[model samples]
Target: MQLTITYFALLRDQRGLDTETIDSPAATPAELYTQLAEQHSFTLPSSALKVAVNDDFAHWTTPLKDGDTIVFIPPVAGG
Candidate 1:
């Protein structure tokens, strides 16, 4: 599937980019995240994250489709 993934804050720093489009075999947000996290050496796991699809909050197990836009949000600390 061809999807656009948007990385934010910590993820953006780790990925070295804000957004990217790629072809992947992952069937769900969780799968895709796990793959990217491994490939990118992301220290934060999906257990500490939230996912969104097409600008709407989505479950990690939600099904993915071609042309979907995904966002992975990591926990943020604010003063």
Candidate 2:
């Protein structure tokens, strides 16, 4: 399936890009993150992030489909 992913904060810095579209065999966000973590050497684990699908907050186990837009949001600190 084809997925569009948006990276933010630490994830974006680690990935070195804000967004990307790629073909993947992952069936869920959790799976996708694991695939990406390995491919990109992301420092944070999936347990440290929240996921969203198509702009809506989604559970990690949410079923993924072709053309889905997903974001893996990392923790943020503000002054």
Please estimate how well model 1 matches the true structure, expressed as its whole-model Cα lDDT: 0.94
Which parts of model 2 have CA positions greater than 4 angstroms off? none
In the order shown, the candidates' Cα RMSDs to the true structure are 1.2, 1.0
TM per candidate comes to 0.94, 0.94
lDDT for 39 (candidate 2): 95
lDDT of 1 at 4: 98
Q: Candidate 1 lDDT, tens digit per residue, 1-79?
A: 8999999998999999999999999999999998998999999989999899999999999999999999998897889
Candidate 2 C-alpha error for residue 68, in Å: 0.5
The sequence of per-residue lDDT tens digits that candidate 2 reaches over residues 41-76 is 999988888999999999999999999999998876
Compute the lDDT of residue 10 as modeled in candidate 2: 84
